[model samples]
Target: MERILVVGVTGAGKSTLARALSGRLDLPYRDMDALYYTGREWAVNDDLVATVSRLADEPRWIVDSLGYPEVRDLLWDRADTVVWLDYPRHVVMPRVLRRSVRRTVTREVLFGGNRETWSDWLSRHHPAWWAWTQHTSRGREIAHRAADPRFAPLSTVRLRHPRDTAAWLAAL
Candidate 1:
């Protein structure tokens, strides 16, 4: 539990879970999104590599994100625990959609002014769209990592339903 990867499809409560994990484990909470989203141009500066290296040296941390392959190696090599919120597609999609609506309506700035617009919400690149398209694809990849012999010692807790995830976290 020293280093935990809290992963899930878009809007599957990854950030919330990661925060809780950080509190429970007495570790730092790293929002990978904030670390990766660097500028107005949306380009990741070379500093991400350095940040990852620094985080890896720490004895404990809870990282929240799933799409950055560039930092995957650093995280995989250091994490001993992975909390996968493998909620059903039906559940995750609605959660994402609602979150989008709220953010857009409120003009909530996320990840340093990265915002949710109604038009973009309806677009293909929307978080909802990403969730729909990437859920099973990424989910399968995570499943493979959990079961693969190369990662044999990794402890993966795959929570299929929200209630199940809640119960598991409550007991932690």
Candidate 2:
């Protein structure tokens, strides 16, 4: 597929899948977190809609995002396919916790020169907590969007398990 959108809750492996798909499909990869963040702060481009709309006009690209409310419609309208990582909470929570721990321990730099810290991991706004609380709601939202008639042109591949995701990527 050409314009692909990888969507899921935080720590659901959207970035990982998008990167792999970009390499396999020979499409450029973009992460919304990088675009929206600036040095550990939320600093969206001045004209976010225009910027994203312009990016969507490109011939080929794969994007990973949390489906920000402001740009969800734009992304859905532009994407020819959506890869939804819909792993269950039981599968996702531990992964998120481990990822947070590893990032914190390693001081791994992330988008916008940000690094996860133990204190940040324990914060209410932590990615692990976000994923735990938003897991079901995010899945439902993606499913609904994928089924919507307005987005009929967009196809979706929903992978409910980590193994399913692996198989799907292998088959690609």
Candidate 1 Cα misplacement greater than 4 A, ranges: none
- The segments of candidate 2 whose C-alpha lies over 4 angstroms from its true place after superposition are none
* Residue 42 of model 1, lDDT score: 51
lDDT of 1 by residue, 51-145 (tens): 88798789988898753888886787788888999988999988998998899999888775678787786677789899999998989888877
TM-score of each: 0.93, 0.93
Q: Candidate 2 lDDT, tens digit per residue, 1-172?
A: 9999998888889999999999999999988877766555545556667777888899898999845677789888889999999888888888898998899999898877888887786777899889988888888888889999898788899898989999999999
lDDT of 2 at 41: 54
**Model 1, TM vs. native:** 0.93
Best by lDDT: 2
- What residue pairs are clashing in model 2? none
